[model samples]
Target chain A: DVKVTQSSRYLVKRTGEKVFLECVQDMDHENMFWYRQDPGLGLRLIYFSYDVKMKEKGDIPEGYSVSREKKERFSLILESASTNQTSMYLCASSYRREDYYGYTFGSGTRLTVV
Target chain B: AQSVTQPDIHITVSEGASLELRCNYSYGATPYLFWYVQSPGQGLQLLLKYFSGDTLVQGIKGFEAEFKRSQSSFNLRKPSVHWSDAAEYFCAVGSSASKIIFGSGTRLSIRP
Candidate 1:
């Protein structure tokens, strides 16, 4: 089975502080993604990486950035965390863009900014 | 760009009863559609996906969904509901780009 591991399951940060959420997938998937899940909003993509050192912004990438130094690892960085940024963050990986290979997501990290 | 919409925000059903969840999409051509289930505080799990071929697609946990091109609807169905099935379900549409758009999601609750 493919396992996606998240660095922290829960986190707390003060407003204006920097935050980092990490994800690692055992599978050799090429595509990696970072998303934030909010109630009544579903899952919104923040950033995605197609290969090592390649990153792209998604629907909601205003206050967020991502790093993919390695193919198996993807990290989401909140430059300046705010109360509104407190939400559940998810990481996903896929084999390709058009292929039927489904997304394997991490357990997710629930961040609370005070 | 492809987008998805799940009309039902919350649904309640009794155990052993049939279940249906509605999903709609907006796309110019046939878009790849998927259904995912998420337990509280967990990641989304793939339930099923429809890329082409047969309109009706079978999925895990005895669940299925039919793709209606005319109406642009892909509704999920199950013969019998289980208490363990109570969770948030999301419908997504994948485009040619490397991104997939997800719906607002529907919260399902099973009554014993």
Candidate 2:
């Protein structure tokens, strides 16, 4: 079965700490995305990469950055974690420009910044 | 800008009851519609999707959705819902482009 795997299921960090959330997909998909899900707000896109090393900001990319150095790996970075950044982060991948194919998502990482 | 709307924040239905979850979208041109379900602490799973051809699409787990371009809505339905079907449902819209916009989601609870 194809899968998008997230490195951590849960993480707790102190304020001002740097954080890294990693995602890896085995499907060889061309598009990778990062989204933060909050209660009542559903999921908001943080960033997405169409190709390796190419990243685009999403609806809420203010406190986040991303790295896609390899085809199968995409990493979301938090420059300085704040309490407001605490939320569930999900990573997803899909075929390029083919929204009809839908997306395969990771189990997600719940980050808590204290 | 593309957007999706799931009006109900939460819904409670009895087991073996027929179910329907509402979804609305706003997008330019033809839109690709999708329905996904997320169990507790699990990733979202694709329930169904509508791109072209038939307006009604069948999905896994006895779920179906109909695409209504005139109303800009894609509503999901099931003849009978099971206890295992209790989960959060998300409606999403996308174009031929690379991004998809998701709705706030509707949490479904099954009653005995």
Candidate 3:
């Protein structure tokens, strides 16, 4: 079975602190994505990378950034964590331009900024 | 822009009862549709997907979804429900081959 592993399932950070959430996929997929899910709002995309060192901002990329240094690893970064940045973060991966095939998702990181 | 709507916020059914979850999408052309299930504290799992071909698509775990072009709907159904079937279901639409839009999700509850 394909696996997408997230580095942390729960995290608490102080305001203004830099935070990182890591994701790794074993499927050798070329598309990686970061999304923040909230009650009533569902999941909103933050950022996505289609290839190594390539990134694109999604609808809600204001407070987040992403890094795809290697093919398997994609990282989401919070420049300075704030209370509003706290949410369940999900990472997903898929084949290049193959959204129809769907994405394999990680267990998700629930981040809380105090 | 592509969007998905899951009108039912929550639904309850008795075990062994029939079940249906409604999903609607808005797009100019036929879009990629998907249904995913997420158990409490677990990651999302793909239940099924519809790309093309037959409007009726069967999926894992005895779940099926029928695509209605006229209605712009892709509704999931199962002949019988199980206690273990309680989970949150999300309907998603993909306008392009790169990005997907997800609905708010419907939480399913099963009773004995």
Candidate 4:
């Protein structure tokens, strides 16, 4: 079975601290994405990577940055964690535009900024 | 830019009742649409997708969605609701390279 695993299922960080949430997929998909899910706002995209070392900002990328150092690994970074940053973060991966396979998501990481 | 709207924030239904979840989208041309379900503490799962073909698309977990070009809608439906079907549903419209805009989502409640 295809699997997408996040580095931490639950994480707590202090305000103004640097935080990183990691994701790795076993499907060899070319596209990976990071989204923050809130109850009313749904899932807002933070960043996405189409290739190693390349990235693009999404709708809500202002408070986040991402890294794609390897094909299977994608990371979300918060330069300075704030209380408002507490939310459920999800990672997803899929093939290039040519394929029909939909995105596969990781279990998600609930980050709490204290 | 493509976008989706799920008007209903939550829907409550009986365990054996029929169910329909509404979804609307806005796009310049013919768009690829998708429906996904997320269970408690689980990742999102694709329930169905509509690209082209018959307007009605069938999917896993006894789910079906109808595409209406005139209305720009893709509404998901089920003959009967199951307790396990209680979850959050999201509708999205896909752009090139799999870029998509998703709706806020609708949370379903199945009352036993």
- Which clashing pairs does model 3 show? none
lDDT of 1 by residue, A9-101 (tens): 999999999898999999788899999999999999999999999999898999998999999999999999999999999999998766665
* lDDT values, one for every candidate: 0.92, 0.94, 0.92, 0.91
Question: Candidate 2 - CAPRI tier?
Answer: medium
Q: After superposition, how far is residue B62 of candidate 3 from its true place, in Å?
A: 0.6
Q: Which stretches of candidate 3 lie over 4 Å from their true place?
A: none
After TM-score superposition, the amount by which residue B6's alpha carbon in candidate 2 deviates from its true location, in angstroms, is 0.5
Per-residue lDDT tens digits of candidate 4, residues A60-111?
Answer: 8987889999999999999999999999999999888576567888999999
lDDT of 1 by residue, B1-112 (tens): 5788898999999999999999999999778899999999899999999989999999999999999999999999999999999999999998643678999999999999
Which CAPRI quality tier does the interface of model 1 achieve?
medium
DockQ each candidate and list the results: 0.67, 0.72, 0.68, 0.63
**lDDT per residue, candidate 4, B1-112, as tens digits?**
6778999999999999999999999999888888999999988998999888999999999999999999999999999999999999999888654587789999999999
| Tens-digit lDDT track of model 2 for A5-81 | 99999999999999999999998899999999999999999999999989999999998899999999999999999
Deviation of model 1 at A83, angstroms: 0.6
Candidate 2 chain B, run of 10 with poorest lDDT: B93-102
TM-score for the A-chain in each candidate structure = 0.97, 0.97, 0.97, 0.96
- RMSD to the hidden true structure, all candidates: 1.0, 1.0, 1.0, 1.0
